[model samples]
Target: MNSIRANPQAGLDIHMLDVQFIRDNLEAVKANCKNRNVTADVDRVVALDEQRRQILQQQQVHQHRQNEISKLIPKEKDKDKKQALIQEGRDLREKVAALENQVKEVEAELKTVLMTIPNMSHPDAPVGLTPADNKVISKVGEPKKFDFKPKDHVALAEALDIVDFEAGSSVAGQKFYFLKNEAVLLELALVQYAFGKLLEKGYTPIITPDVAKVDVLEGIGFMPRGPETQIYSLANTDLCLIATAEITLGGMHRDRIFDELDLPIKYVGMSHCFRTEAGAPGRDTRGLYRVHQFTKVEMFVFCTPDQSDGLHQELLAIEESIFQGLGLPYHVIDTCTGDLGGPAYRKFDIETWMPARGEAGEYGEVTSTSNCTDFQSRRLGIRFKSTKQKGTRFVHTLNGTAVAVSRALVAILENYQQADGSVVIPEALKRWVGRDVISRKGGISG
Candidate 1:
């Protein structure tokens, strides 16, 4: 990796960091962004880059003249010549300082714009702006036919006395809820079941910190210290609540290099992730679909570039197996370029069929896997050394949602609803949940 060149590939537009590289391959960078569905202001990045370069050039010229004039002053014995050299050097210094100041301003502006630009889309990614544009590669199982009008999770939670949205809202504002009775047991069972399965698959189980430093958050591509985004920052510290376990796991190996043999270091991290939901104020506030804080089992992998592709697919398979074990109907969709996050090189989302969330029985995304090919590693300075390969190379990092317990609970409740307002648990999880269906075997009215 060239220190001066930020990845100036044909597909990547040059930013302040990659100005020199972008200057050499300007057309290629613009073309790549276009092909990747990255709607970057390529023209703006290019123009700012040129301005920064011109300012830098002007500063360099002034510094060179200043150096030459200083050397001449020592050789010139005449008073008038010495005075002239000193005056010339002073003028050069002033000009250089002004030009350097302009360069700094442009560089700062370039960073703000470049950081917001989305990563280039994978060539295979479909072209679309929203989830609606996502391509469904496979649809598994079928939506069950209901004999009666099924109550939504919110209604069922109230009717069955399994959740307390009112008390939660009263205490902690809306979108917060307490899982009561069977819902509590069900949540515990789900977390343990998912943890056991990942342990069986040789993943190192760890319950990570729910909060991290702002620098760590930024290293993982999250703007933790910003006010415009959805981060929950601490009052006086440089810390912020982590939006996902991925943030903690991503920071675990920061500024450290790994052995090549440890190439696919898999982690099964459980944490209570927090989000402010800044951009989404009213959306999904009805139930457990969206919330301020929720427990999650996240899967993160650190692998070499050659190993990332297969590892990404493997992570997706693990997510699918978990859903399949739950006996829920789901579809795997290839997320389009526009829908991918800033660090994701490619992404795949598994949307489960939910009958109550939206009109006409919609699907809700339960889990997603992303291949962030060396993007986060580069930012975090994580690398691996291979004996066969010459030097250390940045490892490709990937993250997958194993089970967001809340949303999975939402899907299971809504999709497996019985006519009597009870939810049937998947047969495979009966041993863990200790019940086949969530119902008051006695009565709803205590």
Candidate 2:
């Protein structure tokens, strides 16, 4: 339809704490909310949950009375008595309907409140509110000390004639760009290299849709249609351009039940990601560093709860290995509880060396891996069946960035810039990019 869309939702699908869990462990949930820096009305949710149960009980009572009256209506020999019983049954039916509606109202409100509670932080995760409190897990590959002045990626790219923000901004808007010459080749090579790496690690590679239904975005805990939302939603439509492949990949098994044999399903997804950049740090509208759109190679996994912790580490390890292969100076950060998003039970970030991030060189986030234990699965209704278990259990979900191509470009362009204004391609991606260096007059396009 060419018509304008209507009533797009501006709220988040965040806050998926278990109601029964909260009922049993109210203090713990409350404490977790405080640690995570979110408002969780634990007391109010508990109160409403209690009321919800009471309404259910009342419904049952009404239904039971209706059933009895229905039976009496058929059996009564006196016509007048039979008619009276029928009227009673009708009244009971109406009362039961009213009780059901009231119960729905209570449950809806309870659920809304309960959604404010986030996943509990991993006990090993540091307790803090921001990146400043994040603990450094490890630093890999020492930063190269240049004898000559090092040029930032922006300047190097311009000199090499590989990236054009001038053309991009004119056509689209700021933070959008055209990757020209070797830069374009480098982007493709990064994708191919990352895909090959994940394939070697036994992942099935796929290219996900750049757009997904709004509900799918919510299921993955990506709040859409908000002024502060990173997600870019289509107006009057049911879809939004994805900020990450995670939204589509995480929702793949939504409302599905997997058998125990398929206990682990790991996918390597590549997609062109779009974001409003509304959540960009410090409102900084700079280079490809804060872009409106970019290509990403992401890894997503659906596994049994017992398997997710190991998988989480494996994902992070893969991310670390990728940057290491590129020879970028980087470090692993154990994300603090308060900084962990609503869906993340535990998270780790990899920050790579950026020679010209600010006034001086600093580490900036390049990749993130999260173990969203049953948070997405519960809301998405993705579960697994075990013969040993009588009922299904929600699967644990995990996502890791394999290569955020734009940032990888940033690291490469800056880190590999020769004193002569040339940039050497990462050895691992050379074959696919078909080049060893991007230099002025390098014999490709001008």
lDDT per model, in order?
A: 0.80, 0.85
Determine the backbone clash count of candidate 1: 1
Clashes of each: 1, 3
Itemize residue pairs with steric clashes in candidate 1: 11-32
The global Cα lDDT (0 to 1) of model 2 is: 0.85
Q: Of the candidates shown, which would achieve the greatest TM-score relative to the real structure?
A: 2
lDDT of 2 by residue, 174-278 (tens): 889999999889999999989999999999999999999987887788778545888887888999999999999998778788997887999999999998877
Q: What shift in Å separates residue 358 of candidate 1 from its native position after superposition?
A: 1.9
What is the Å distance of residue 441 in model 1 from its true position? 4.4
Give lDDT tens digits, candidate 1, residues 1-446. Answer: 21132432211222322445555666765665664566667567778877877777777777878889988998999999899889988888888777767766776678777665555457788877666788999988998778888677889878878889999989988777788887877777788888888888899999999999886787678887567667888899988988899999988998777999987999999999888888897798788889888889999999989888899889999999899988889999898866887788899999998888787678899999999887777667788998988977878899999999889888889988899888888776678777777775623233
Which candidate leads in lDDT? 2
